[model samples]
Target: MNKTTLRRRTFLQGIASTALTAASYARVRGANDRLVMALVGSGRRGREVMSAFLKTERIELRAICDVYDVQRGRAKEAFKLAPTEIVALEETLQRKDIDAVLIATPDHLHLAHTLATLKAGKHVYLEKPSSHKFEEGSKLIAAVKQSGKVCQTGTQQRSGAHYRRAKEEYFDKGKLGQVIFARAVWHDFPWQRRKIAPQPKPAGLDWERFLGDAPKVAYDWIRYDSWRYFPDYGGGLLADILTHWADVAQWMMNETRPLNAVATGGIYHLNDGRVNYDTVNAILQYQNWNLTFESSVLPIRNERPGVLFQGTEGTLEITRADYVFTPYKGEPTVVKAEGNLEVAHATSFLDAIKNGTKPSADIETGIAACNPVHLAKAAYWHKKRMRFDETATKMLSD
Candidate 1:
């Protein structure tokens, strides 16, 4: 067998051998049963997700986990949580009372955190770009399957009512005929490029824990505060912002895997000691169609954050607020988004657990959506066209 296949088999074998016992699995909850949930990471995104979970009925916040005391304090203050509720991830996972975990950790910690949560026999609501590296996607899928838990990925658009309606009306019914080209864009605002001043590491902040498996280095406030722009912790704008729109494009097109990808970008504007690029443009080649994604933190004219699908018959554009379709010869039709996306997504996760149904953005769906972004990054880094081997779940050498 090839090296990639061998590696995949070995990883799967390891997961199977270490699978949790039957008794360790989380018990099924009834329709009205209260779900005892914990929040991991407890950062800005974590707090936002926690707020959404609070809006859902019958969800009890049992614990909160974070490495930084300041972040923990912020979560406690925003949620009215008790000081005792703050716990380390290791201790929190050991609690039998906790039924599920909402993990909004950094990209690098996603695979490790989600795998540990699944191994602990708890359901997970993992944030987007599920894996830091492409190979970790299969590991996550295998662990979730072994644990048989409802693991939802935080691509909230998948659970949105308007998104579903637009899919059903336009792409699903052939209203947009034979879509050939698609574009996803997410340009950053000026505030996103704010300068970070170097400061001493805060007291009681576990910098090592925050670093996770990343290489050890002197504490830099920029990397700690804006980890998304760093290559070690995150995939920059592509993984942070483009993944959501790419997932939507893949979902609407019913094409999950991309055959190959070509990407180009650089840190032209925001020279803030970040390794990741500030401007990026990538094109993913599928079986029959192509999808492109572009983003830059620098100022650009008429910049909008959304996805556009162009077909033979018409064109459609969708964003967080709304979706509009304009036929070749008819007036454009617009549909405004309704309800809270995060709240709806949280509710869907709860419903999936209680009903034994797959969440809108399950583990497999999450990985599939992320794979293309990973491929694009590979192409960008290598400066060559990169192809993906779906069976072995690895990027092929040029």
Candidate 2:
């Protein structure tokens, strides 16, 4: 069969599978019902998010999955989980007891893991930068839609009280009138840089499985430990750091789609074997405003990472902890943040599952947040301006 015919058939098959899966798991959960959760990719980041999820009420982590025995063992000890509770991802998904899956795998494996979780009739709490590349986003969107599952993206700021207040008091209420430009900044510390040392791969670590769809190469400890610094496993600063700030900018401005983007950066410092840039400066154009994100690993300044919006009437700068609004004519106002972001985000996910409502950061919002970052990365890689075609979901050279 031709490509189009094959794709159509595959789409139809997916719809049928989703229908069957939904029918088999069609039990409406009430508010008081306990949620059985499974933690996939139980590495450092995975365990951190899992702990936050556990803070929420009426949820139990029934199973944990990780390719590396060491990481899995760490998770088991940290969470006081039984040996019998550990299982492979496929086995964990097969169990009907799991109501949702928390996925914090490498960027490349997110699409596959999330799709599998959804197909198995379980809700998903996927980490940020949902897809490794822009091309994988459409597939994820389709899978989430067809499965009718509540997929919450891990943009914790979306659930932040300070973020909402900043949006409502400034952008939404015209405190920051006619906002024209916004900037997102993240400065990495020295401790974040991974040490480059030649050593044997740790026993029980599945190097090949960790590679996923990335290029096959000899095991490098630095790459394994600092996968975010490499293009194969992650999108460097753009995908790793910028996604959060850009999401905040878009969320507060109420504009998720960007028209075009251009980026320029290089691996200035940290002369490691990593291919992805260490510093990046990207600009994304929207309908009424422009957004820019800049990140650097070099110890240049001690400013906290945040998003700032400059408007005609005033300017608003916001971070996870608080927000400051400085009017052009009047005195400045400050609002301190409240509550734990991770717990709040997890609670939103649980509430969505129980109430059948959308999450604070749903799949579409997640994809939209990543859209500009992807375009900016592509622009940097290709050394050309990239335009996003929202309807076609394609990035084109400008």
Candidate 3:
């Protein structure tokens, strides 16, 4: 490793040790001492995470911030928070009582929000795809290490019992002998087959704030509500949905980043005038195995939203709900998953905060999961195979 990376690793190690000691001390406290958390960006995913966090008895939602009045109003109605509690991001961060901030903002704003939250001396539960660009993820890693705060990425599958068991029993135990090919797929039809006419920006919506750091554009509700379709706002299907399965593939294969990437797909069906592609098939090569990921907005739901591992002995298919294992010579086995994964992941974040431990999906793990995502996008844009540096810390131009 380079000197800078070595130094950062050493620094993070020291912080982890100190946090572990602090967690032990914190454990002695009473159960009444709950952690205060605030939600920034009360969008769909934000509300989902908040709902999961609400299931955790150890956390109390003290504040909710959003650029849209509708989302803030909905959050207030659901959580029964006072009008004063639904405020702006700056005001939410200023509150000293908030122990942690759950950030579910758009892709373009993730870096800015995360950095501001860290600077405000609050732990962060950042959603997936750590940064808008590949290089920005490194800055986040450094910031997390320097702050020494519990930062959990939203790859909740890491905390799922099924994923843990699969990783431990099948992959780690060498049961999935010589895993050669891993395929991840996420297919859904969340949009209309026809084109959508642009609507006026809704009242009480801060369009400028929502478009912070993104390229300035005329206010359009289609872009605002379904921001994932735009390049400036989101990373299309790859970043939005593929991130989950890519993370799982990386975790199962015990890989941080891919060796190279080549992609070929486009907006073949959904012609909604969206800047980003609707259908994308990307192939990422790793040292030991290869991962092929395909995502689209097609209505066909064949083998929808799951990861498949092909090994010498057998093939294992894993989803958030359960896993199916099939051996070459034996009958296929199915394992049903128990408990709520979202709640478990939220609890892991709270535990990490109270105990000064790293959450199952820590900052580094988030960065690792994002590697192939950013690379695939790059490959699609450049129309050329892309590779990461030897250290897998930086993306190569070629």
Candidate 4:
């Protein structure tokens, strides 16, 4: 067999073995009734996801994993978990009792942790902006497909009430006919970036483990606390909020990848020693339409953050909770969102696990959402337009 085929076969065999092992453990522990879950990386986003999972009584949070003792202790106290439950990921994934894991680690660690979780025979709920680099997404997608697991991405908008309605009632219905252009904007005032001096590493902190697969760097409080500002840990605002809007655009348009991308912006306000830009304006060109995305932490306009779809007959404005339809000649109509998206998203994962189905934001969907953000970053860094391959699987240089 060819090398690629041989590798794939071996990977599938490993997954089968893991599944059989987990199945035996599940039968012994009555896991068919309720799924046992573990939370990896108990930071801000980790706690937020924990809250959402708690809203549903279907799954039990059995363990917490983190490199730092502080986050592990915090999660343990908040969740009434045992000290034994607060352990390393290597230990948590070894627990066959865990039917699934919620991976809220940094972007750089996502690919490794996700691969390990899938290999360990557990379902994964990974946060968005799935990888630190663009190339890592393909590996993640391949692993998820081979493992035959229910892996969900944390693009919660796909499960939101208004967002669903907008796609079904407006976009899919063609009420906004012949959509040619779209604009998405996120303008807000973030807290000022401050210089944090380096301090001694905390006890029980596995610094090297936190830097897995990332370039070696001395531990700094600023980099650790504000990881989004550095490329090693995060992809800045592009990977932060831009990925959400890009996903929404792709979902609304029923498209995955764009044909070309260009971006322009800089760290206009935050003079702090951050590597990412604070202001960004990017455009993604598709075969049938174009999507323009802009994000600025400096603009203090009266308008809140939203996305606008301009079609031939009308325009639809959408936010996290609501959507407004403004026809060319008729009065505008608005729909307020109903239900909690976080709960819905979490519930969907559990349902998918039980039904052996795919969640709304699966691995492919996550990669589709994250692809444009990576392209935008490339365009910004290179100061040139970038072209996406015909298959939309790889980004090509200009």
Candidate 5:
């Protein structure tokens, strides 16, 4: 057997051994109760995923794991689950009963957490900014293939109805015939980038555990909840917000990868000592599409941030909650509302699990859309136009 296949098989064996032996409690009479899940990394985001799963009725959360003792309780309280609490992320992976894990920890922990989970034979719902670096993302992609696990990337916009319709009208329907230029923008006022003062350490919080795999640093109040402002723990605004915007572009462009990227902006306006940018505008090039994504910490935005996919006929505007299609021929916007993206996202994932079909927003999509975020950040972070360096493309040559 090949190395990739062998790795995946070994991962499955490890996970299958951990199946929930506590008690096989059946679900409510007539729902799709095929797979039970265990949640890993119970952060604020992890709890949210758990809450959604609680409503799903399909995924019985068997365990909730986190390095922080404080986090595990919140998840238990949220799901009212008798989860086998795990101190380390790996222990969570060892559970054979957990068919899947939702990883919502800090970015730096993603690589290790995902690698361990996949190798242990579990499907994964990995949160955005999929990996800490381009190389890490590549590695996770290989692990996914080797494990033969279904991965749902947490780019929830993929399930947005407005986005689907916009893509259908613009790209699929070709209503926006031969469109080329697209600009994605996000404007956030200072109140949005606001910070709180440093605080006394809280008990039950495993500071060292949270710092797993990240560069060593003294506790800073800003780094705990606002970890995205730092590079080692998060990719900053580039991977955080830009990935969502790029997903829209990727959807509208029919899964296009940028040929090159140029980024310009700086950490101006926001007074806090944030290492990431406050305003970033980037230009990304595809074979036939030219796209620009703009972000701001001080723009007076009436709506939350999203992307605008411009086409020859119209532009598709999308937010986390909804989307809009505007015909450029002096026409009004065709607004579309996606009732609950979280619901849709979960339902899609559950459906994939049952049918053994690839999810709409799988890891491949995550890798493709997020690679540009890294490339663009590399461009501006170093203040230079960057080119894609193809050293190792993974087993699938993706």
Candidate 6:
């Protein structure tokens, strides 16, 4: 680590003890008054998270912040908030009256948004993967300590009943024998296929504002909306989707950090013109066992949909729905499964905000999930079977 990070880390170590006490002591806002929130980035996922936040009875969304004015207007109409339009993210964060901010910005901007929000003393509901860089996540973790903000990650599966049940019933201490391996997969048509091209920036859209922290580039609608396929903006499927699997893997394994990470996958499927592959896979090895997460852009369904936890006593399958408990009692015992977790995920964040507690998917948990994600993606990109760097270990897809 660098001196600045080391110094900040040391300072954060001291603040962690007393910061929550300060948050607890702060004067409570009015019961009738809704917490003022700002939504940064009006992308598809951003809108989804906003919809969840807007569902709450006590939240009065004050402003919608986005670089693209079209998205801002669309979001404003969706949430019915007369958004205080912001192109520059820092300006949006500077509003002292805002109680919290939701960052649905791209991978590269996550760290900036998290740091800025914490510095502004507003709690954050940051989207998945925490950040693009592993070390940057450490910075955000440190910042959270210094700020004492109730930061929540976008890994909403933790709030789902089925996932929670799966963790408790199967992965809990000696519950369903020992969890030997977990396989998570997300497969679907490549996100780049049907996205529209970026039209000319409308009069209200602040192109520069939307490009915050990202490299300067010309406008392309496909690039803006389908940036997940491009290295410059998104982490493709790994950061875009697989982080949810990573979060569950950590939850199931009861682990915060993976001792090693190796990923290997190739672009064998989709012929979309994007640099990112259509298929990607990675394995995160913890102290006791290993978990594998993969995605294929050509087909959305997995060999076994959702996440599969193979244990000694039984095989527990946890997907987007209800989990399946198939006991290996000499003969197979079949249990059907189904799940709808959208509402459950939404409820947890608002509850945490009101109760002054951490949400189910907190920042530390989000960062750890992304560590393997970033490591594995790097490995896949470099085409190495096994590559260990200071940040995270990587293995090529077989």
lDDT of each: 0.88, 0.86, 0.86, 0.85, 0.76, 0.74
Between candidates 2 and 5, the one scoring higher on lDDT is 2
lDDT of 5 at 55: 78
lDDT of 5 by residue, 1-398 (tens): 99999999999987776554322333233434557788877877888877876676677777777766777887787766677887777667776777888888888888888888888888889888787788787788888888888899988888778777767755788876677887777776554477678787777667787888788888776787677777878876778778887887877777546777888988788768788777888988888888788877676564656676667777666676566667767676656574778878887888887799988788888888788888887888777777674542321111
- After TM-score superposition, what is the CA distance of residue 300 in candidate 5 from its true location, in Å? 2.5
lDDT of 2 by residue, 1-110 (tens): 89999999999999999998886665434333778889898878899999898777568788888877888888989887663445467898999888999999889889
Give per-model TM-scores. 0.89, 0.88, 0.89, 0.88, 0.84, 0.82
Q: lDDT for model 6, please.
A: 0.74
Encode model 1's per-residue lDDT on 124-229: one tens digit a residue: 9999989889989889999999999999999999999989999999999989888999988888556558898889988868888889889999888888898877
Residue-wise C-alpha lDDT for candidate 6, range 313-345, written one tens digit per residue:
888777765677777775443444334355555
True-vs-predicted CA distance for residue 210, candidate 2, Å = 1.3
Q: Candidate 4, residues 324-378: lDDT per residue as tens digits?
A: 9999989999999888888889988988998988898898888889988999988
Model 4 Cα RMSD, Å? Answer: 13.5
* Deviation of model 5 at 133, angstroms: 0.3
Q: What is every candidate's alpha-carbon RMSD to the true fold?
A: 15.6, 14.8, 13.6, 13.5, 12.5, 14.3
Q: Give the TM-score of candidate 2.
A: 0.88
* Clash totals for all candidate models: 0, 0, 1, 0, 12, 13
Q: Which candidate gets the maximum lDDT versus the true structure?
A: 1
What is the Å distance of residue 149 in model 6 from its true position?
A: 1.0
Question: What is the alpha-carbon lDDT for the whole of candidate 4?
Answer: 0.85
